[model samples]
Target: MEFSSNIKKLVMLVNVTNSPTESEAAEDAHQAMLNISIPQTLKYSGVRTQSGTDIECSANETILCDLGNPFKSDQKASLIIIFETSGITLFTEQITSQLQLSTISEQTDLLPVPVTLNVKNTVLTMFSLEKQVMDTSFSGSVIGESAMNSTRDVGSPLEFVFRVQVLGEPLGDLGRLVIDFEWPFAVSNGKWLLYLTEIVIRGQSESHCVPPGKIVNYLNLTLSKEGTKRNKREVESVYPHAEASVTVLTTRKVPQFLDCWRQTALCQSFSCPLSNMSTQVEVRVRARLWNSTLLEDYAKALRVEVKGKATLRLLTDKPAIKMENHTREFTVNVDPVLGEEKPYEVPLWIIIVAAVAGILLLGIISLILWKCGFFRRASRREMYEAKSQKAEIKIQPSETERLTEEF
Candidate 1:
């Protein structure tokens, strides 16, 4: 008997002790009935026959094989059974299975105990998802948007817009989106004063908007900058318009945790089973800078650098057909407070101090130059004349030198 991983085949051999002659074989034909039971994870396909004959059997019922006149006394006979996997097998490790056989006799002269045979699978059983042909890809990006004024300010409406797309065919049945935020969104004390006011989901075929009343109150807001709105608008312009889409959000409240610096995650089932169709998810989160203290560290401009990242996961019933971790980062400068309107003017004391310092520096530089004879430098014409006089004196003898020589 042989059973292997690549080919799910079971073979059983039986020996006949009593055999009749060929003339009497027509009156008594060897017949056997076998029971087949399999795990839920595996589905039973039809058995393979040697004569190429089709056998009809129900999917849910146990398979019974009728071997007609194949066995002979003192002759070897083989029975083959085949099985196939059902939906999916999540286990990748090796598994052991045993095939046991027993016999029963109704005659009083025969033994009451049934004969038994055990077959064990000794070879390594390898299970992998490589055989499942699938094509899927995931990508996403996050941005900040301002609703009230162009500038970010306290109590002003802000938005963290996230756009995720699952491209290619044969997508997953479920999806998960996790966003990690910086200090502006959450604090060290685990206190979330910033409220997530709204959540809007936009797809190629459908769109949904959830107001503040429906959302949970304990969510936080990430820091955003003036330039984020421009980026958000650009994403919207290129958003794909379609008649069919996947619904990834099924719950009203988004889950929040402190581990990811007040991370937020949304997990939902697809409206339909993932198939050879492209799906897009656009989530617009309305927020506010209710925690004014988050911006206290910045001076002059109410600027704060906010950072966030998103991870998208695609999951299906089959663990083998899975998408890896797809993560993206977005960082922007945000001004939580209103921008300073008045023109920046120099302070009176600062101007006086600057003027005094400048005068002192100039005086020191002038003194140094004067000591090095910079102030006593002669004109170009005077320098030329001095050079000529020196040349003449060198060429001729001085009067005093001539008198000394005569003496």
Candidate 2:
């Protein structure tokens, strides 16, 4: 079975004509006709959509639009409009618009109509948005140093002021900023206790829209000496009871890192002493940019890392003394004990004693020799007299023989 019915079509028409008459009634009629067409002209003015240039339509996206009217006239009207869509669901959605219509009056014949009307749309979603890190940089320096004792001791306390500057721009909603400072195990040669005494941070930003609310003003960091094997072994050999201590004003356990935001400068004073005779200390600083709610679960996709180093010398405080060279010239004085010529005089008693001892020794030796017949000698005068007597007797005998021969 087929059913057919005649649908009634409704059509209406009105004549629009204008004529110039020298009468007030004709002018009033012309104004009334213009007013009647204002609503129809506004209805066909069209809807203009305004949004971000980089907009990519996704779930729960906010879109802004403006409604423009093309007519220039003084007329008042109220609009109640509804939007209908198909094949999509909205969660916690709201649409708002602001409209102002001009009033039509006899005194004011023509008025400018507002061309644009502003509207806002909010769309809610269940998924979170991803953040982006724009730029990052870090720098650090050693500001000053303080020694607790006048004479450096093995476990004496030394303080150093370290300043670190962190700069970054987070394109998405900022989550957290972390700054890490790593001191080398050889900083104190494991002989001294090293720890942070105080930490102060100040934050600044190029964009005024971002405040310094998420900054962490203070952080206490305690580094482990166990990380350094060589220095710890040497320290244990010298001081068996030596152990690293936390020097921070608070007794809380030291944090390994610090969290903050934007362009920031952190100044920290560390208390470390020359536990042994270490002359230099070295420290490393690392900064990370994180976009996450918690510090440990930092977003690796939008993270930045920067590193720096600082070295402190213990002997920088001592003053150096230089020795001046000098030359000396000597001149001998001739008028005194150094130059006066005097003969070396022997003692009279000593000379006499020496001479008498020599004479006694000579006499004793002579008397002993004479007693032993060592000086006996023959008589030359007696031998000569006996020879002369023998010669005279021989002469007498020869004279007697000569006399007898003559007789």
Clashing pairs in 2: 154-275, 191-275
Clashing pairs in 1: 170-275, 224-334, 225-333
Give the alpha-carbon lDDT of every model. 0.38, 0.25
Model 1 Cα displacement at 201 (Å)? 4.3
Tens-digit lDDT track of model 1 for 281-359: 5555555533333322222333344444444454444433344454454443443212221124456787789999999
Best by lDDT: 1
Worst 10 residues of 1 by lDDT: 130-139
Per-residue alpha-carbon lDDT of candidate 2 for residues 1-407, written as tens digits (9 for 90 to 100): 01011111111121222223345332322223121122211222222123211212111122122112222233222222222222111111222222222322243433432222221211111111111111221111111113122111122122222322211111112112222333221111121112222222322311111113322211212322321123445433322331223221212122122211211213222322222211121222222111111111211112222222232222221122111111111111111111111223456787789999999999999999999999988699988999999888743457778899999
Q: How many residue pairs clash in each candidate?
A: 3, 2
Candidate 2 yields a Cα-based lDDT of 0.25
